[model samples]
Target: MFKKIAVPVLLAVSGVAAAAEGTTTTGVDLTPLTNSIDFSTVLVAIMAVAASLVTLYAGVAGVRWVLRTVKSA
Candidate 1:
């Protein structure tokens, strides 16, 4: 009984190990995929400009608010 159960388990484990080792080599080139229109730089520049505008607007609004408050006082 032990021999029967152990033999099938060992065979299943060996089959799984062999299947894991059988890797197919890919022949596809990925240079074109990597070189195609990188947008990270443009995205970063746009994000920087947007952030600067938001900061400038915030500064201007803060100054205006302070001026109005001082004037009211």
Candidate 2:
């Protein structure tokens, strides 16, 4: 009973508080590091390579299992 009422009230209060705060910004400059490249693209490429390697390993293991089963039979 208390939970349902309290949740809505709390949400309403927080919404009002956030609206009051608005979009305030502090003036901090990052112009010095503009020349240094963003590593986001490189990070994504590395993740792709890792995923491909894992898939290849799984595929090779499956092939080896099939071959061993055939030989035993």
Candidate 3:
């Protein structure tokens, strides 16, 4: 409907405006050794934490299911 078309239209207009800006037209300029710490290593650590939380939640859910089944029998 209108909602679906409106999103794309707005996105296209925003993209066009961004392209008109010289900064967006050209790629970002960055120098090497700008930071003391590597960002990639931080990202990997965050991902590992998120994965561990997911596994923990799944294990808890399974345990709850087993207890519920036992109580019903």
Best by lDDT: 1
lDDT of 1 by residue, 1-73 (tens): 9999999999999999999798668767889997998899999999999999999999999999999999999
Sliding window of 10 residues with minimal summed lDDT for model 3: 24-33
TM-score: which candidate is best?
1
TM-scores of all models? 0.52, 0.51, 0.50
**Global lDDT scores for all candidate models:** 0.95, 0.93, 0.89
Q: Global lDDT for candidate 1?
A: 0.95
lDDT of 2: 0.93
Report the C-alpha lDDT of model 3 over 1-73, residue by residue, as the tens digit: 9999999999999998888774545666565546655799889999999999999999999999999999999
TM-score computed on alpha carbons, candidate 2: 0.51
Model 1, residue 69: C-alpha shift (Å): 0.5
TM-score ranking from best candidate downward: 1, 2, 3
Candidate 3 ranges with C-alpha deviation above 4 Å: 1-37
